[model samples]
Target: MTDRPLPNLDHWIADLAPALGLGDVDVPLRPLLDLTRDVAHGVARPAGPITTYLVGLAVAQGMSVDDAHSVVTRLVEERLE
Candidate 1:
């Protein structure tokens, strides 16, 4: 099987969110992208999305997205250090 390059996720999300009833929702793509990079590099490739899912769960539980990203990022940085 040939490896296919992924599309620009941030662009895709911005384009698709409106159609998915999240038009007005502002996703903090920068922090999330940063978290994905950090987690994938510091931990494991699969951990990136898993960590993002946890961050989303935390947000749903009343934690700010920024705060969730900060907490996870800090943990990854500390563990990798």
Candidate 2:
């Protein structure tokens, strides 16, 4: 239950994405990692996963991943200012 990512993250995601029924989807791992890190640091540590989940929902509802990331990043930046 550590926060550290697996050493072989690409392999892990390859196995995990299909298992989660997203086999055909290309996950933007680096952007997501960056988003979570910002949310965790700029907000609360516990907010990281929640914010990521919301971004996923936004994408599913037709928002582009980049747009979703931008929205969340903006919110974090504003909160930190």
Residue 24 in model 1: lDDT: 64
Give the best candidate by lDDT. Answer: 2
| Residue 29, model 2: Cα distance from true site in angstroms | 1.0
Instruction: Please estimate how well model 1 matches the true structure, expressed as its whole-model Cα lDDT.
Output: 0.82
What is candidate 2's CA lDDT for residue 66? 96
Q: Which regions of candidate 1 fall more than 4 Å away from where they truly are?
A: 1-11, 18-23
Per-candidate TM-scores read 0.73, 0.83
Considering every candidate listed, which one attains the maximal TM-score? 2
Candidate 2 error regions (>4 Å)? 1-7
Residues 1-81, candidate 1, lDDT per residue (tens digit)? Answer: 123433586578878889877786667777787788889989999999999988988997999997998899789889878
Candidate 1: minimum summed lDDT over ten consecutive residues — where? 1-10
